[model samples]
Target: MPAIAMETYQDHFDRPLQERSSLEPAWLLEHRKQAMTRFTTLGIPTTRNEEWRFTPIGPIAEAPFAPAVSVAQSVDQTVVSHVGFADMECIRLTFVDGRFVEDLSCLRPLHAGVITGSLGQALAAHPELLEQHLLASDWWHAHPFANLSAAMSVDGAFVYVPDGVTMDVPIVLLNVATAPGARVANYPRSLLVLGRSAAASVVECYVGTSYGADLTCALTDIHLGPNAQMDHYLVQRQSPTSFHVGALGASISRDGVFSSLSVQIGAAIARNDIYAHMGGENVECTLNGFYLVDGNRLIDSHTMLDHAYPHCNSHQVYKGILSEHGRGVFNGKIMVRQDAQKTDAKQTNQVLLLSDDAKINTKPQLEIFADDVKCTHGATVGQLDSDALFYLRARGIPLEDAESLLVHAFAADVTDRIRIPIVRQQIDETLLARLPSPQH
Candidate 1:
């Protein structure tokens, strides 16, 4: 069969700024104009681009129609109840169809200097913070989808932790796309301003209940103050027929620590981009991700860790499991600037393919401009160990059970890094459910 033409995929690019121009601020209006121009000139990404050469987006280009507007949906309490974290208490914020639902949320009274609310409400209540960190557009212009999201996103969450306050409970953001054919896109922009010595943890869940063609574009921005420590987790389990795109950027100050964990299991086509900058001395950042792809699904994860100051350390490890005709992509880059002496950065990407048709493309890169830095990267793509399978079978385990056990062990390596027990357990169950059954 012949391949589909890119131009026919109008739904991906037909969303012009004028369609929703009236909903944004004057500055945002002007910015959207510029962004639209850039998007029009550049158009959709092609395989010719070095960054996208391995992963073809023709399937996405040929997808039909625009995302659905406002559709009615109800959360299946049974399904929602199945997803829970029991290790620690949290302020649960829920959103259905990309719109905040207060009745479904649970917020506990917090200590001083912590503000959590819908982005729209926060804009009205705390305009100054919004003006400072809402959309720092100058930092990046390579991804046109990011610009498109900034222009069209309607509802999301906003969290701000004031100086000198420690939040013991994790602030959880649950975004659920319930309606089938719902074109719900949200830009959940969070600005974490931790005063010196403050600490907090956050969890973000992206889920879908119905199986329809949906589109989700989410953006999260985090800022860590000096001596602050934060752990951020992003869990995605949308419909298998949906399109998901996300971008996250973090700025770390002196003596700060930032830990990130990303889990991907749903969506027909999903892409996640993360960028972290160590702006202060003695800062440490850890980036970890795990993804599972089955059937014809595709999941892509890209990251960039920038070391700009002295005595900064970073570690990145991403692992994936592919089955059937599933495909996975992982691209990681580490940059050490000239002033970033005494920097230690390491990155690794590994993939395990279960079928002959399954495929994975992985790349790990290190760019060092400092002579006194220690930076290294490695990537590997392979199948499960036949020797290990034989050993399991020799121990009287069934072949299918052995395969499942090995696959789960490989994935558990990453899940164990998750400090939140509730989040870890939820991910474990979701992954097991998505994996191929032992009988298969």
Candidate 2:
């Protein structure tokens, strides 16, 4: 008979540290130690938790997965060349099974004062910066997964831009996971810091190959200095049998501008959390997301924009397309503190269901303590319009083709907002090919 299975979460956390903390600097060692303790105390949030009421995580909590480590097998070069943004000219960092592949990366000829490379290397070369910015987000202690990532992450993407510098091209970081035999887990961490008056753009993509039980837990922290500007994009495409939990936290300074677009199209159970803080006056922030879920998949997005000072502005829009019993959840929150007078905020959530079985949960909220501010939020869930389908069918289009056209039209609202031409086109093509077939 097989041995009784142990509790996966406890078993994994109880294991000894993969790397010896004693050999590292005291600050990092203490940080890791405290993070682990906090993770254990918090445990995994259950369905009972208000924030996670809609998404169930039993499959993840029970998976017997070990922390991902470097592998001897090399990734095929062709595989790296064929992924998204391949045609664009940009510095690329490739990782296989959560470990950085130096031979597969291109980081040379970068503009002066711009740093782009691996987090592991950055930890060695720029310890003070890493120590200052790592796990420094206000939301860091609010989630167990964030603590777990901070405790176990070994490698990730790191980018730093100095004062008055601007990157002409976007920087891309790609993560690919392969699990041939057993269940595994990867902790991918990223840190982006911009000095005063700096400007840059970045893309972070996560793709997986193994359609088996696996987990990818990722965390990213971005800080923009005064008068800095930054644009960030995140894409996640895991296998149907994989689980993904990710977080993106940002801090914008006075007169700074920050914007983000997150797209999710894969994973059995995926949850993405985004938090932005306007820490200084006259800051501008925008957050947008799009997700396509199908085949019993569940995608959850939670975002919060905090106006901490006067004259800050924030805007958010999240949209989803669900089919075949797929489920999508969107929760957005905007908070204007007492001191945040002259704040402007707007939020909207929309979902399109292609199948009768498809489901969605959307909630947009705003909390304001300031007497002089403008805030608004709304949510909508709808299916393909029969009138539009009839109009197309009457125009000599086949039934299936007519339905596909309407579906594409419903999704165009979000895709059209994507700034990168290649990224937008790729997503449009993928969604077009996945349009639901007409029923008899």
Candidate 3:
């Protein structure tokens, strides 16, 4: 942590516990206290931190960012229409600056036994449920950012799908940040639970407007019961001057199916940490990610898939495109415990550099303790194929156009993995508009 940033943040963190903990119950207050203590002890991570070695976070630590407060007029209805996925038929819950805006949200005709709304509201309406799940475990205490988010998180999205219930359409959890200016921060926390035999799809989008040099640290916990199935997508499109760090922790039960797609195309320095655990037999997991960065931006993705039971399967693929002086990092690990016999897992990471200055650091690791398990991991980094560019240019394509064509082709594999047509098309267009100019 930078000295000036740390000194400034200490004041931000010194708010009286009573002032921040007034409304919550005793259990929650204690939870916040414990997390706050951990945050103080751990402080901000530096290059010395193994997980943060490749990604330097001095800019974020030095910035004087206080927690975001609610601004009713900051977000209007028009902003939603421009963010894509607006045409989809799904339940929409909107939040601005970490506070849920009930007026801007669209929630109607929800399915039977389904619960979706603000996390703070849910804590009041369904204390028992929130007590059973939110901040109930020590899983998040190990990370400083997650601990800070838990300690300072005021509001976010919450969803609960009862057993045997299947949602016909996806649920959109939209978080918008309209900062009055830079030097502000927002802590967004999400809890999604799917009961036994239930199925649903969820889309979590993080976007910012009129914000320069801001910060957002968000965390999400997804719990799936036995035989439950869930399709999760996390789309990050914050302002180019902002900083973002997000963590996703998931638990899968027996015979449960969980798949996640992560697309990152925004933020000056962005890092995403995803961890999925299979607790029961026959569970299946899939993790896919796509990232595009240029012009000195840095994007880092760290993922872990853990198998604790027998006969489970896991597959992961992450691809990246870096241009100009952009930088990227991909570190993925798959672990199979001794009890996890018959486990099958595979992990791959591929990176494309559009210029000589573009750089990437990739590491894929697999650790298997079970003799019967099969695991493999690999990573590849390379520049655009000159042969392919030449072929396209020979076919009457201009040099710039030919370069874009090859770049698009390199990205096609990841684009085809997206199941939502509108999102796919939107990403296609966004990638083209941001493609780096080919250097002569």
For residue 72, model 3's alpha carbon misses the true position, in angstroms, by 2.6
Residue 166 of model 3, lDDT score:
96
lDDT of each: 0.77, 0.83, 0.86
- For 60-177, candidate 3 gives per-residue lDDT tens digits of 8776688877785867887888787567778888989888888878887877879999999998899999889885455566788988888778888899999999998888899888
Candidate 2 on 1-440: residue-level lDDT in tens?
01222345445654645445544577876777787778777778878889999988888876456876666274566666556555667788887777788777777687776888888788788888888887466577778888888777777888999999998878888888776456788888888999999998888888877676878889898999999999888888778889899988999999999999998998999999999999899999999989998999999999999999999989888989888889999989999999999999999998888788889988899999999999989998887788888898889999877877777777787778877777778778777776565333
lDDT of 1 by residue, 1-440 (tens): 02242233234434544554565566655755565556455566767888777767665555433433444346644545656742247887776766676766777897876888787677668777776766553544577566655544556788878777788788888877764543444444444556677788889888877776677777677888899999999898888987787888888889999999999998999989989989899999999999999999999999999999999999998999999999999999999999999999999998988888888888888888999988889988887788999999999999888998999998999998999887888888878877763223
Model 3: how far residue 356 lies from native, Å: 0.9
Measured with C-alpha atoms, the lDDT of residue 208 in candidate 1 is: 77
Candidate 3 lowest-lDDT run of ten: 1-10
Best by lDDT: 3
Compared with the true structure, model 1 gives a TM-score of 0.89
If the candidates were sorted by their lDDT against the true structure, best first, what order would they fall in? Answer: 3, 2, 1
TM-score against truth, every candidate: 0.89, 0.94, 0.96
